[model samples]
Target: MLKVECKKWNQSLEILREEALQAEHPRTRERLMALYEICGGTNATLVGKKTGRNPQTIRSGYIDTMNRV
Candidate 1:
Protein backbone atom coordinates (compact mmCIF):
# COMPACT_ATOMS: atom_id res chain seq x y z
CA MET A 1 0.00 0.00 0.00
CA LEU A 2 2.75 2.42 0.86
CA LYS A 3 4.53 1.62 -2.38
CA VAL A 4 1.41 2.21 -4.40
CA GLU A 5 0.78 5.49 -2.65
CA CYS A 6 4.33 6.60 -3.28
CA LYS A 7 4.06 5.81 -6.96
CA LYS A 8 0.83 7.74 -7.25
CA TRP A 9 2.33 10.66 -5.42
CA ASN A 10 5.36 10.69 -7.69
CA GLN A 11 3.16 10.60 -10.78
CA SER A 12 1.08 13.45 -9.48
CA LEU A 13 4.16 15.56 -8.87
CA GLU A 14 5.39 14.89 -12.39
CA ILE A 15 2.05 15.95 -13.82
CA LEU A 16 2.01 19.13 -11.78
CA ARG A 17 5.54 20.01 -12.81
CA GLU A 18 4.65 19.48 -16.45
CA GLU A 19 1.61 21.66 -16.11
CA ALA A 20 3.68 24.38 -14.53
CA LEU A 21 6.13 24.19 -17.38
CA GLN A 22 3.36 24.40 -19.98
CA ALA A 23 1.62 27.26 -18.24
CA GLU A 24 0.45 29.99 -20.59
CA HIS A 25 2.55 32.57 -18.80
CA PRO A 26 6.10 31.98 -17.65
CA ARG A 27 5.59 34.00 -14.50
CA THR A 28 2.65 31.91 -13.44
CA ARG A 29 4.95 29.33 -11.87
CA GLU A 30 7.30 31.96 -10.57
CA ARG A 31 4.41 33.81 -8.97
CA LEU A 32 3.35 30.61 -7.34
CA MET A 33 6.81 30.20 -5.88
CA ALA A 34 6.88 33.82 -4.78
CA LEU A 35 3.58 33.41 -3.06
CA TYR A 36 4.90 30.29 -1.41
CA GLU A 37 7.87 32.27 -0.14
CA ILE A 38 5.82 35.26 0.99
CA CYS A 39 3.53 33.04 2.99
CA GLY A 40 6.52 31.85 5.00
CA GLY A 41 6.79 28.80 2.74
CA THR A 42 3.17 27.95 3.47
CA ASN A 43 1.84 29.44 0.21
CA ALA A 44 -0.09 32.71 -0.14
CA THR A 45 -1.23 35.23 -2.71
CA LEU A 46 1.59 37.70 -2.52
CA VAL A 47 1.74 38.44 -6.23
CA GLY A 48 -1.71 37.79 -7.58
CA LYS A 49 -1.51 40.31 -10.38
CA LYS A 50 1.78 39.00 -11.55
CA THR A 51 0.50 35.44 -11.41
CA GLY A 52 -2.73 36.25 -13.28
CA ARG A 53 -4.70 34.31 -10.72
CA ASN A 54 -6.72 35.14 -7.62
CA PRO A 55 -5.61 34.30 -4.11
CA GLN A 56 -7.88 31.32 -3.83
CA THR A 57 -6.80 29.85 -7.17
CA ILE A 58 -3.17 30.33 -6.37
CA ARG A 59 -3.54 28.78 -2.95
CA SER A 60 -5.47 25.79 -4.21
CA GLY A 61 -3.16 25.20 -7.15
CA TYR A 62 -0.07 25.43 -4.99
CA ILE A 63 -1.51 23.10 -2.40
CA ASP A 64 -2.54 20.62 -5.03
CA THR A 65 0.87 20.70 -6.63
CA MET A 66 2.73 20.40 -3.34
CA ASN A 67 0.55 17.55 -2.19
CA ARG A 68 1.75 15.53 -5.16
CA VAL A 69 5.23 15.70 -3.72
Candidate 2:
Protein backbone atom coordinates (compact mmCIF):
# COMPACT_ATOMS: atom_id res chain seq x y z
CA MET A 1 0.00 0.00 0.00
CA LEU A 2 1.49 3.32 -1.04
CA LYS A 3 0.47 6.70 0.19
CA VAL A 4 0.82 9.89 -1.83
CA GLU A 5 1.96 12.61 0.50
CA CYS A 6 0.58 15.47 -1.57
CA LYS A 7 1.48 18.00 1.07
CA LYS A 8 5.13 17.09 0.70
CA TRP A 9 4.87 17.98 -2.97
CA ASN A 10 3.14 21.25 -2.13
CA GLN A 11 0.21 20.31 -4.33
CA SER A 12 -3.42 19.34 -3.95
CA LEU A 13 -5.49 17.09 -6.19
CA GLU A 14 -6.92 20.17 -7.89
CA ILE A 15 -3.47 21.49 -8.58
CA LEU A 16 -2.45 18.18 -10.06
CA ARG A 17 -5.57 18.19 -12.21
CA GLU A 18 -4.86 21.65 -13.55
CA GLU A 19 -1.28 20.76 -14.24
CA ALA A 20 -2.29 17.58 -15.97
CA LEU A 21 -4.60 19.46 -18.23
CA GLN A 22 -2.11 22.20 -18.95
CA ALA A 23 0.76 19.81 -19.56
CA GLU A 24 2.01 19.93 -23.16
CA HIS A 25 3.62 16.54 -23.20
CA PRO A 26 1.56 13.40 -23.27
CA ARG A 27 3.76 11.56 -20.80
CA THR A 28 3.74 14.51 -18.43
CA ARG A 29 -0.03 14.66 -18.53
CA GLU A 30 -0.24 10.95 -17.87
CA ARG A 31 2.04 11.21 -14.88
CA LEU A 32 0.13 14.15 -13.43
CA MET A 33 -3.17 12.36 -13.96
CA ALA A 34 -1.83 9.36 -12.13
CA LEU A 35 -0.83 11.52 -9.17
CA TYR A 36 -4.12 13.38 -9.20
CA GLU A 37 -6.16 10.15 -9.20
CA ILE A 38 -4.04 8.49 -6.57
CA CYS A 39 -4.17 11.51 -4.33
CA GLY A 40 -7.91 11.59 -4.80
CA GLY A 41 -8.09 8.03 -3.39
CA THR A 42 -8.05 6.05 -6.60
CA ASN A 43 -6.47 2.60 -6.52
CA ALA A 44 -3.21 2.21 -8.40
CA THR A 45 -4.60 -0.87 -10.17
CA LEU A 46 -7.52 1.10 -11.56
CA VAL A 47 -5.32 4.02 -12.52
CA GLY A 48 -2.94 1.64 -14.25
CA LYS A 49 -5.76 0.04 -16.16
CA LYS A 50 -6.97 3.46 -17.28
CA THR A 51 -3.46 4.43 -18.31
CA GLY A 52 -2.64 1.09 -19.99
CA ARG A 53 0.25 0.44 -17.64
CA ASN A 54 0.90 -2.28 -15.11
CA PRO A 55 -0.24 -1.64 -11.58
CA GLN A 56 3.28 -2.14 -10.26
CA THR A 57 4.60 0.34 -12.81
CA ILE A 58 2.02 2.80 -11.63
CA ARG A 59 3.27 2.29 -8.11
CA SER A 60 6.97 2.33 -8.84
CA GLY A 61 7.37 4.60 -11.85
CA TYR A 62 5.77 7.93 -11.00
CA ILE A 63 5.66 7.24 -7.31
CA ASP A 64 9.40 6.86 -7.28
CA THR A 65 9.83 10.05 -9.27
CA MET A 66 7.37 11.81 -6.99
CA ASN A 67 9.46 10.66 -4.07
CA ARG A 68 12.57 12.16 -5.61
CA VAL A 69 10.81 15.43 -6.33
Candidate 3:
Protein backbone atom coordinates (compact mmCIF):
# COMPACT_ATOMS: atom_id res chain seq x y z
CA MET A 1 0.00 0.00 0.00
CA LEU A 2 1.28 3.47 -0.79
CA LYS A 3 1.12 5.86 2.14
CA VAL A 4 0.22 9.53 1.77
CA GLU A 5 3.42 11.45 2.48
CA CYS A 6 2.17 14.85 3.52
CA LYS A 7 3.23 15.83 7.05
CA LYS A 8 1.00 18.91 7.24
CA TRP A 9 -2.30 17.38 6.22
CA ASN A 10 -3.94 14.03 6.78
CA GLN A 11 -7.11 14.23 4.72
CA SER A 12 -9.36 11.20 4.45
CA LEU A 13 -9.88 9.57 1.09
CA GLU A 14 -13.60 10.30 1.28
CA ILE A 15 -12.95 14.02 1.50
CA LEU A 16 -10.87 13.85 -1.66
CA ARG A 17 -13.63 11.91 -3.40
CA GLU A 18 -16.22 14.49 -2.38
CA GLU A 19 -14.04 17.35 -3.48
CA ALA A 20 -13.57 15.68 -6.85
CA LEU A 21 -17.34 15.61 -7.21
CA GLN A 22 -17.59 19.32 -6.40
CA ALA A 23 -14.63 20.67 -8.34
CA GLU A 24 -15.71 23.34 -10.85
CA HIS A 25 -13.12 22.71 -13.51
CA PRO A 26 -13.42 19.55 -15.55
CA ARG A 27 -9.67 19.09 -15.63
CA THR A 28 -9.42 19.66 -11.90
CA ARG A 29 -12.19 17.14 -11.26
CA GLU A 30 -10.56 14.57 -13.52
CA ARG A 31 -7.21 15.00 -11.79
CA LEU A 32 -8.90 14.81 -8.41
CA MET A 33 -10.49 11.50 -9.33
CA ALA A 34 -7.05 10.18 -10.24
CA LEU A 35 -5.74 11.50 -6.94
CA TYR A 36 -8.55 9.75 -5.06
CA GLU A 37 -7.73 6.42 -6.64
CA ILE A 38 -4.05 6.84 -5.81
CA CYS A 39 -4.83 7.54 -2.16
CA GLY A 40 -6.98 4.42 -2.02
CA GLY A 41 -3.91 2.31 -2.80
CA THR A 42 -4.59 1.93 -6.51
CA ASN A 43 -1.44 1.69 -8.57
CA ALA A 44 -0.58 4.83 -10.47
CA THR A 45 0.02 2.87 -13.65
CA LEU A 46 -3.33 1.15 -13.32
CA VAL A 47 -5.07 4.43 -12.75
CA GLY A 48 -3.29 5.74 -15.80
CA LYS A 49 -4.45 2.80 -17.88
CA LYS A 50 -8.01 3.14 -16.70
CA THR A 51 -8.25 6.91 -16.87
CA GLY A 52 -5.98 7.50 -19.86
CA ARG A 53 -3.62 9.59 -17.73
CA ASN A 54 0.10 9.01 -17.90
CA PRO A 55 1.50 7.28 -14.79
CA GLN A 56 3.71 10.23 -14.04
CA THR A 57 0.75 12.55 -14.52
CA ILE A 58 -1.25 10.55 -12.00
CA ARG A 59 1.50 10.74 -9.42
CA SER A 60 1.90 14.44 -10.06
CA GLY A 61 -1.82 14.99 -9.58
CA TYR A 62 -1.72 13.01 -6.35
CA ILE A 63 1.10 15.15 -5.06
CA ASP A 64 -0.62 18.36 -6.12
CA THR A 65 -3.87 17.37 -4.41
CA MET A 66 -2.08 16.38 -1.22
CA ASN A 67 -0.44 19.77 -1.03
CA ARG A 68 -3.73 21.56 -1.72
CA VAL A 69 -5.41 19.76 1.15
Candidate 4:
Protein backbone atom coordinates (compact mmCIF):
# COMPACT_ATOMS: atom_id res chain seq x y z
CA MET A 1 0.00 0.00 0.00
CA LEU A 2 2.79 2.41 0.87
CA LYS A 3 4.58 1.53 -2.34
CA VAL A 4 1.48 2.24 -4.37
CA GLU A 5 1.04 5.57 -2.64
CA CYS A 6 4.65 6.43 -3.31
CA LYS A 7 4.26 5.64 -6.98
CA LYS A 8 1.24 7.86 -7.27
CA TRP A 9 3.05 10.64 -5.49
CA ASN A 10 5.99 10.32 -7.85
CA GLN A 11 3.70 10.42 -10.84
CA SER A 12 2.02 13.53 -9.51
CA LEU A 13 5.41 15.16 -9.10
CA GLU A 14 6.25 14.33 -12.70
CA ILE A 15 3.03 15.89 -13.91
CA LEU A 16 3.73 19.03 -11.91
CA ARG A 17 7.25 19.22 -13.33
CA GLU A 18 5.89 18.90 -16.86
CA GLU A 19 3.30 21.56 -16.21
CA ALA A 20 5.96 23.87 -14.87
CA LEU A 21 8.09 23.23 -17.92
CA GLN A 22 5.22 23.96 -20.30
CA ALA A 23 3.93 27.02 -18.46
CA GLU A 24 4.25 30.17 -20.60
CA HIS A 25 2.59 32.94 -18.61
CA PRO A 26 4.91 34.47 -16.07
CA ARG A 27 2.15 35.04 -13.54
CA THR A 28 0.75 31.58 -13.98
CA ARG A 29 4.14 30.02 -13.67
CA GLU A 30 4.85 32.02 -10.57
CA ARG A 31 1.58 31.02 -9.03
CA LEU A 32 2.24 27.41 -9.92
CA MET A 33 5.68 27.55 -8.38
CA ALA A 34 4.30 29.13 -5.24
CA LEU A 35 1.63 26.51 -5.04
CA TYR A 36 4.22 23.81 -5.61
CA GLU A 37 6.50 25.16 -2.94
CA ILE A 38 3.71 25.37 -0.42
CA CYS A 39 2.00 22.15 -1.36
CA GLY A 40 5.16 20.16 -1.82
CA GLY A 41 5.39 19.41 1.89
CA THR A 42 4.92 22.58 3.90
CA ASN A 43 1.97 24.40 5.42
CA ALA A 44 -0.68 25.66 3.01
CA THR A 45 -1.71 28.63 5.14
CA LEU A 46 1.77 30.06 4.98
CA VAL A 47 1.67 29.95 1.21
CA GLY A 48 -1.77 31.53 1.07
CA LYS A 49 -0.66 34.41 3.24
CA LYS A 50 2.43 34.88 1.16
CA THR A 51 0.41 34.86 -2.02
CA GLY A 52 -2.40 37.00 -0.58
CA ARG A 53 -5.03 34.37 -1.25
CA ASN A 54 -7.17 32.17 0.92
CA PRO A 55 -5.50 28.86 1.53
CA GLN A 56 -8.48 26.76 0.53
CA THR A 57 -9.15 28.89 -2.52
CA ILE A 58 -5.55 28.79 -3.63
CA ARG A 59 -5.31 25.06 -3.10
CA SER A 60 -8.49 24.26 -4.97
CA GLY A 61 -7.88 26.72 -7.77
CA TYR A 62 -4.27 25.70 -8.21
CA ILE A 63 -5.16 22.02 -8.46
CA ASP A 64 -8.09 22.72 -10.75
CA THR A 65 -6.08 24.98 -13.02
CA MET A 66 -3.18 22.58 -13.21
CA ASN A 67 -5.40 19.60 -13.93
CA ARG A 68 -6.95 21.51 -16.79
CA VAL A 69 -3.62 21.94 -18.52
> Measured by TM-score, how close is model 2 to the native structure?
0.91
lDDT tens readout by residue for model 1, 1-69: 001122444444445455556678866766434433443433355445555668665555555554455
Count the clashes in each prediction: 0, 0, 0, 0
Stretches of candidate 3 above 4 Å error? 1-3, 64-69
13-69: candidate 2 lDDT, tens digit per residue: 899999999999999999999989998889888999999999998899887779777
Candidate scoring better on TM-score of 2 and 3:
2
The segments of candidate 4 whose C-alpha lies over 4 angstroms from its true place after superposition are 1-22, 64-69
Instruction: Give the top-scoring candidate (lDDT).
Output: 2
lDDT of every model, 2 decimals? 0.48, 0.89, 0.74, 0.57
* TM-score, cand. 1: 0.35
**Residue-by-residue lDDT tens digits, candidate 4, 1-69:** 001122334546555556656799976765666556654665656767887878776666665454444
TM-score of each model, in listed order: 0.35, 0.91, 0.74, 0.49
Higher-ranked by TM-score: 1 or 4: 4
RMSD of 1: 8.1
| Total backbone collisions, model 1 | 0
Residue lDDT tens for model 3, 1-69: 344553456667887789899999998898778777877888888988998878777766566556666
The TM-score-based order of candidates, best leading, equals 2, 3, 4, 1
Q: What local lDDT does model 2 show for residue 53?
A: 94
RMSD of each: 8.1, 1.0, 2.9, 5.7
TM-score of 3: 0.74
